[model samples]
Target: MDYMVIPDFVERKGSLYLRSDHMNYSRATLNSNWHQAREAEPKNYDINVFPKPPGRNLHTATYERIGHLKSKGLPNTTTKSALEQISLKPDFTERETRKSMVDVASFGHAIIDRELDAPSRGFGAVLPRHHPDYDKLHLETTHKADFTPPYPYDPAPERPPDFPDNSKAHRRYQSQFTDTADYRRSGRNTWQDESGVYGNTEDKRTVFPRTNPIPERLVQGLK
Candidate 1:
């Protein structure tokens, strides 16, 4: 089966081997050219052959070591000063303690007063004062006189030239109802009827009586 394998199948199977051979050939060609160039120039391998030492030693002191060495010979004045300044126990002597308490109270009071007096940092505070619209905002915030009519002196349409007095006009209008016979017959004078039934009048000015009156029951209740 290997001998009878198709040529295309064999070529496809050996594609990786062919690619590796081509890469090796290219590498070998470049190496040969490099060797020839080196031989032509003939560089001396003995002269400073190893890489030059770094400008500074690789084992040079690190920051931690440098700081430790620098401070080793110096007296720790900073720590001593801090220790001296700090109070291990508060003094309860009456005058000193009272002064300290007063100072603390004053400090808190000063903070509160400063906060209260500080200018507000709200939107109104940041609004531009010089803007053209600022005047309109100021006007809106301020109180002004109530609006007067545009034509205050215009004599109110000359009063129709024949307008009647208000009392006379009202009486004339009321006469339409007061002068009618139906209005007179509607019993507008009293709230109760002659039979003592409340709100049973023709005009219905009050609530209607819910129960019919019994003469016998009324007489018995009265007795």
Candidate 2:
């Protein structure tokens, strides 16, 4: 009989001992020196693998806590430590006391008095005929009154004797040819009539058939 030997078990002095195949068995041993050496070395950590926790922001937190004190009617102690409080009393005695000391003849008053005495004239105001500036103004006005706009180079081109000059007459003349169907039919008939003159009867023959009921002359002699 053959007995199978277990790879993980070893027979030492008739006692079976389990063998350890761990790669770091030496470091994992129960030795005081290995433990002390590992403890003495500083541990290094990667920020990408082991991220740090986000701590509280003191600036934003402080601003939010004291934000309401910056508005109106609230006590702002940054600029001034002691602030003057306003009185709600409505006494008019001080205004009346200083009324007499105010100057009545100021620069503005002088200007108003001067204008009232002799007012200034605007551009639209008419000048007297005897004034020295009236002659130049009269000359400029006369020149403007005599001014005339220039005419174009081809203002009136020569027209044919049969062409109508008046708008109504021109429209009436154009109305004779305005019927496009009649114009096209007449043009086609004229071409057929004069086809013999050009010695090209193909167009006429193609347009009018030999079995047409109309006379040959009326059908443009297609046959």
Candidate 3:
């Protein structure tokens, strides 16, 4: 868990949609995970996410599209923003499109981190693992025989001063957030005058739309 994307209570439909990319863990797995965080918070545990490597399905395509959009001066374009603009909340989708589609326009796991453990300075204790691939805590120290993450992970991270036992149980996973409008509600009025920000129709299209505008060539020079 890197960061939970709860919308501001007063945010608008589009703004309150201050949307978040779905947590990537499987539904059943995610259930177990949240439970673990609830139980483990007092003992000094934390759940974190990391950037997944590139060149997969929709994740890659979204990542690529993000890069392209960034180059054209699209300041806040991100996967979460693009999806919410189209009313496509990853959590709400019947089936996750990330696994099936070729996405390269958004940040999958690289740019953001979610706070999994609630309360207690965003840390937890005795975290639960949803999927076999996900780590229970940050990998700042070596795993003991009881730890259960897949081996061959990055063996070293500068351990945080307050972290006890070096966080061997938690390993970071991929991120699904972006700077798109739906994901963040703070600056919409400033950058969302879709008619054009720079007074250029083409450039204004760079803004994420409220629908799937990527294939429509809505923003031609983005990224």
For model 2, give the 10-residue run with minimal summed lDDT.
Answer: 168-177
- lDDT of model 3, residue 129: 40
lDDT to native, each model = 0.42, 0.41, 0.43
Q: Give stretches of model 3 more than 4 Å off.
A: 1-72, 76-84, 94-124, 128-223
Candidate 1 achieves a global lDDT of 0.42
Q: What's the lDDT of the predicted structure labeled candidate 2? A: 0.41
| Best-matching candidate per TM-score | 1
TM-score of each: 0.13, 0.12, 0.10
Which stretch of 10 consecutive residues in model 3 shows the poorest summed lDDT?
Answer: 41-50
Query: For residues 119-141, could you state the per-residue lDDT of candidate 2 as single tens digits?
Result: 24444434323445655644456
On residues 109-178, what C-alpha lDDT tens digit does candidate 1 reach at each position?
A: 6543334443455445533345455557444422334565565585656667686434422222222333
Q: Once model 3 is optimally superposed onto the true structure by TM-score, how far is the C-alpha of residue 153 displaced, in angstroms?
A: 63
Model 1, stretches more than 4 Å misplaced?
1-129, 138-171, 176-223
Residue 29's lDDT in candidate 3: 41
lDDT of 3 by residue, 1-223 (tens): 6998984445454332222344544223433245544453332212233335352233322222233354554345587677667664555667643473434665474454556455423245345445654666666555565586775777688978885442322432222233234544454363543332232333333442356637646466563
The predicted structure with the larger lDDT, 2 or 3, is 3
